[model samples]
Target: MSFASLLPAAVLFALSFRLAGAISAQTFAPPSKGPLVQTANYTSFSNNTLHNKHVVKGKVFDRIIQVWFENTDFATAISTPAFEQLTKQGLLLTNYNAVTHPSQPNYVSAIGGDFFGLQDDAMFHIPSNISTVVDLLEEKHISWATYQENMPENGYYGISYKAANYGNSSAKPYSYYVRKHNPLMVYDAVSQDPARLRNIRTFNDFANDVVNGTLPQWVFVTPNMVNDGHDTTIDYAASFLEYWLVPLLTDKRVNGDRTLILVTFDENETWEIQNNVFALALGGAVAKHLHGTTDDTLYTHYSSLSTVQANWCLGSLGRQDTNATVSNVFSFVAQKTGYKNVHVPANQAPQFNLSDVAPGPLNSDAYIPFAAPNLKARGAGGGPVFLRPGLNKTLTVEKLPPPVDLYSLKKAVPWQMSPRTTSGKNIIPCADSDCK
Candidate 1:
């Protein structure tokens, strides 16, 4: 549906008012102190931890901050008053899309380049051998971190955390922090590392990081389930952004110094339709002339990885990041970096609504073992491709044989035990419940 058709007259009036006088940074107070706050008697791990902060200059933007919301269709989000208002402050990406359904896979693909056939929101532990954008950033000595709101502790491994005395007493405790929404925690390479885990901090850590001028180069921020709209509405998510992000946009510590902030959703709400989610680029990196402009370039979750790779001239994971059909660098970044993006007609674009459609090592029913990346494939970054050790160099994902029917044979896949098996049941402790 057209944005104009979806936008109500009342919302349009509000948008006009918002554009006339944009919300001020002083309109809302700073984020509240959470469980990670440090007091004279109590010290949190995040407070004592020293986060890595190397300022690696990029071709377009020095820093990138990704703030992900929950499921909301493009039209639905754009029709909202706050979203429409916010669009006037930055460039709107009209053709941005999510890779697959549910949410975890999209989050995983955002950093790892490929989801490895993840189809559910179940707790998964990707093997350490698989390299992510984290590896690429670290290879160039570029610091990165993920700030998850309502996460009880730093580098927390619990499946979920519920706030005490939340909501009605008759109902179960409100699960504010969930593992599925956290992308870095799903990968064993990041979660198992003591240093990397410490970097996976809470919202309180975010406030502290900003206060101390210790924010990293790359940041992934996930609000709680309610604030992200997973358990609430888009209106609630917008309210949270108004309360939190609107103030931070003008803050020198968070959004200044050529920082590129992307406000986007994980996926669309309607599964039958294309996974087109509303996304916008804001911050000091956005040129003054580009404000309130719209870029209709087709982009996917993989584009997040590709854009970062192109901006920093980093090596490619050689997965979907090299796939021209799906991965396209942000137009502004591509223009500056001299990266050519493929423009597929909207009709020819891949339908990303289906889940478990692709076969990979992670899918037990139609399973194919892990294969080496296409070393010859060049990406927007125009750098050498990163190859994980122990991968079969002789086999490429394209050249791999037909998937084996492991489920029929009652065989378990390598890496970790299959989630269907009893052994894998204990992989995620206190899953979908209040651990503490």
Candidate 2:
């Protein structure tokens, strides 16, 4: 059915949805729900007509920055004073959601457009032949880069940094540059390609680029564990952004009317939380009047790709992104309005990063990062269990034993497969170790 046909119901429903607004940042409610502290309030906009309007033209934003944070639910994040204060400076998507649980698959889905049944944080490779948003950006001649904090070196391809200071790996104060949160590293094309490999740099590079006005057209930034609120609280991540990133948004070289910045988390606190995360859309590209407004559209991680694809008309990754919804708040941009269809090819399923690549240059250990968790998709087994103790019940990835007698939580079972192979078939951690 056409979106036009669905408008009346959606608008009426939006009227009853909670609306987020820019009130006095100094006065706010106490935190609730998760690790740190989070959006509801959608229909309270002073300008009620905005609900009826789909697109509004304004400045075009060619430069975009995406900052991804760790697991934090909306309720908890909203309680965070800084995150709440920051919401006033831009459009808040109250109903936004992450694509999946655990950090790896969501990050993968953000760039690759599909999850491919990823259930753990293991190191894995995507084939060089398969394309990502990186390919689309490059195809359109748009420059892009991925900057991560605390990485050992530029293009360093490891699952995580050795503890920031040895014992700092403790869950509450977790701190490190984990590869699982950095999506670009898993792309075989970027990792194996020399020139593209260098594009994945540390946050220091991002700092320098911002100072030098050398930021790329599309930039992906990830903070360390503590800074992203993974092993810490939302207050930690919010303070990091408030102090480090907020200033950059004012510098014309780093941000302005022609640029867009998104501060979003990878997933939610628990599966019972339904994968909701706090999301903010701000920048020169965002209409000024939209600063304190809220968009209630139910967007997911794929919307990240969809927004960029729509903004640049970059086509699609031939996956769910081809059909994923774009950020409706930015409907004002002319480029976003001009195109709708996302180009797709028939063979769009994820081709493992190790597909067809020789082990000589690429090994299973480095290419495939996480071990199978045998997590059940259903309540008894495979499905997510959000009602757990501690702050990061799901995102704190586990380390399974190696192939030589790998672990079986319930009973002994054997499963193995090469990560960097074209066939890419292996032992998936089924509920009963049922690989079939």
Candidate 3:
């Protein structure tokens, strides 16, 4: 059979559409005509050293709230009133897709730019040195927080809710909250820091924060499994969004003129959907003219980090996020900020190995750190190292992964995205059972 004959017609059609819509970074955004806003101790997030001002600035956010739904396909999602209603009020990304499956890595990619070899929802932890957008955000003095429904307590890092599971001791109790769905839990930078850890509060606390006016500048919210359509149906998830999230849209503080709330699913339900998922940009931050408009820009989890970095002028990690495409909604700000947004090459942003779990030392790198330049550097397996920034000098280190010659100043290749097992079942130990 010919190479063309090998692909199913549906998949071939989908790939063709994606290729046809390959747009440039500035297609939606024209050149930024606005003057640079000068603030004390601030710099532009743009990577162009020439464009570098003092700090991460621009028409960024006083607040950005993102709510992630689970496992619903695009066609089914858009048909729902809750999602459709959002499109009417905001920009719709008609060609958005998730990077991978079983959830965790997509969440990781959203913040870190690269999946770092994570392929399953297992309670996998990334080394602190691996770095997350949090590093960039905090470097610019930006604040962030995550809220999880049915989370046991503030900064609690357990697995599931026995209370919500109806005491069904059958391993893998069905509950609203799961750590795999909460991305920050795996990061030692946030989870290990007592100060940052406290910010990982429960969903109930999210409402409290909103009422108390303590909402952070960046808020990531995750609904329980039922609400996110993990164990429940898409219709239920839509209802959950309508009942819970719709109210937030009316809040001036949340959907206020400066606030941008991204509503998207983690990935599609099965392996055959090609990862297409419904995505919406709704909030006060979106321009009025852009509302009700559907932009067919192809985007993935990496785009979220791209948008954040672009909005704030935070430099890229030189990873896939540096290469990922930007969404259409950001054109308004990009047109104003003159931020350089680059398009990721096709099939380059770590495609999924879906058929099997990947092997060891997944990614090797050419650029090892001479010294940490405000970027976290990990010893082996992501242990944090305290290196003086701006010194550009060699220093003593902590634990280093075996076989890596740090002395040569060889770039530490963090474990890239792990391929998944054939089963792709997220098995966790629950007493004597494999709860999944």
Candidate 4:
């Protein structure tokens, strides 16, 4: 059916308001039960009745949105191909930063709009007042889902990645923050409801669900750790994106018209104060070469969550995301129709310093760096080194001889190097962990 044909009486009512600049002082009837969701109304603004009638575009209904996550954890190798392609297609947040250290707190900050200072993956009970983006969406009747890559029972997290109780190891677990996202499991109201629970699905199930016509308004797709570039090589991560993310970008129902896909990292390998591992916002209403132009805003994960919350007019998530502080990443609105597909840059692994690679510097910050519970022992600036907590050491990294683990570099000498500074203020702490 045509959109015009599906326009509800509310359009006419809204048109009246638009015409007068104020709603009529009358008994406005409640919305009727209708299947079609309304986006806007056409109101005449010009005096010419024939062709000159001004068509005043008003509001659009809740838009269908998706946040496709890549292994943005800065500590690990990043997905370069995906980054180039996505940035050209949409908005690249050159200044995006994760609020807390480690994966769980960043995820929590992204969803909940504030991290309650969580620093580890020890599985503490989710707080009742910990309002999430999902919670706000639910209050407004907007639907959302998290589609994991290889999570077996939808939200499964093995005690170890090799736990037999959870069955064989899968490819999706690494991509999704299983430890942090587990709060969705604790929300009794959502967990008990089959409709909400069923929304949590696997990536393979997405196409059928779309064909079966069950796509939600918002989707969070996380690939496994290996594919997300967390534990595996960058080349493997690029292949995963080529196979999984690219297909979804090309889907008719998921892309074009008025859809958005946000790709971001949880945090960097180093628990330092930086904004390098930024996010890319692609699909619908984004501008290109937003790629190299970094937005030097002091934003964290809460900012991203706040942006989503504001887009839906869902309000704030506490002191962290008050009306004034939310990140304005989703500022662009779609002006044209049809698909403006993203073009991936031919060059791969765009050379970058530690800051360009991840969101922040390594453990320079006492909070996330030394304070974070997972700090490995400081190793020599050489290959596959370990950092014992409190070991003060510096490893001079040569540009490309042996590909040492980036995480080790971030951990060992977190102090700024080339433009290195002696000031200790640049250090960032790992969330929920002890700091000196």
Which candidate number has the best lDDT? 1
lDDT of 2 by residue, 1-436 (tens): 3212333564334322422322222211211121111101110111110011122222267778899888776666665667777777788876677866567778988887666545456566665654677777766567788877667567787666643243222323223667777888887768888878878876555555555556688889887766777765666677777756776776786776678888898887655435667888888777778887776665667777767766665556545565434222234442345533322232432222212222111222212322222223111011121221222223322442222212223222111222211123443343321111
Query: Which has the better lDDT: candidate 1, or candidate 3?
Result: 1
Ranking by lDDT: 1, 3, 2, 4
The lDDT of each candidate is 0.79, 0.57, 0.59, 0.42
RMSD values, in order shown: 6.4, 16.1, 13.4, 21.8
Model 4 TM-score (2 dp): 0.55
TM-score, one value per model: 0.86, 0.64, 0.70, 0.55
| Candidate 1: clashing pairs of residues | none
For candidate 1, write residues 20-89 as lDDT tens digits.
5543222222235332243211123345434555588999999999999998888778977799899888
Higher-scoring candidate on TM-score, 1 or 2: 1
| lDDT tens per residue, model 4, 392-432 | 33321122123233334554323222222211233335332
The candidate with the higher lDDT, 1 or 2, is 1
Model 1 CA deviation exceeding 4 Å by range: 1-3, 6-45, 49-53, 165-172, 407-436
> Ten residues in a row with the worst lDDT in model 1?
34-43
**Model 4: runs farther than 4 Å from truth?**
1-79, 155-177, 181-183, 186-189, 192-195, 273-275, 287-298, 326-329, 333-436
The better-scoring model by TM-score among 2 and 3 is 3
What is the Å distance of residue 76 in model 4 from its true position? 8.7
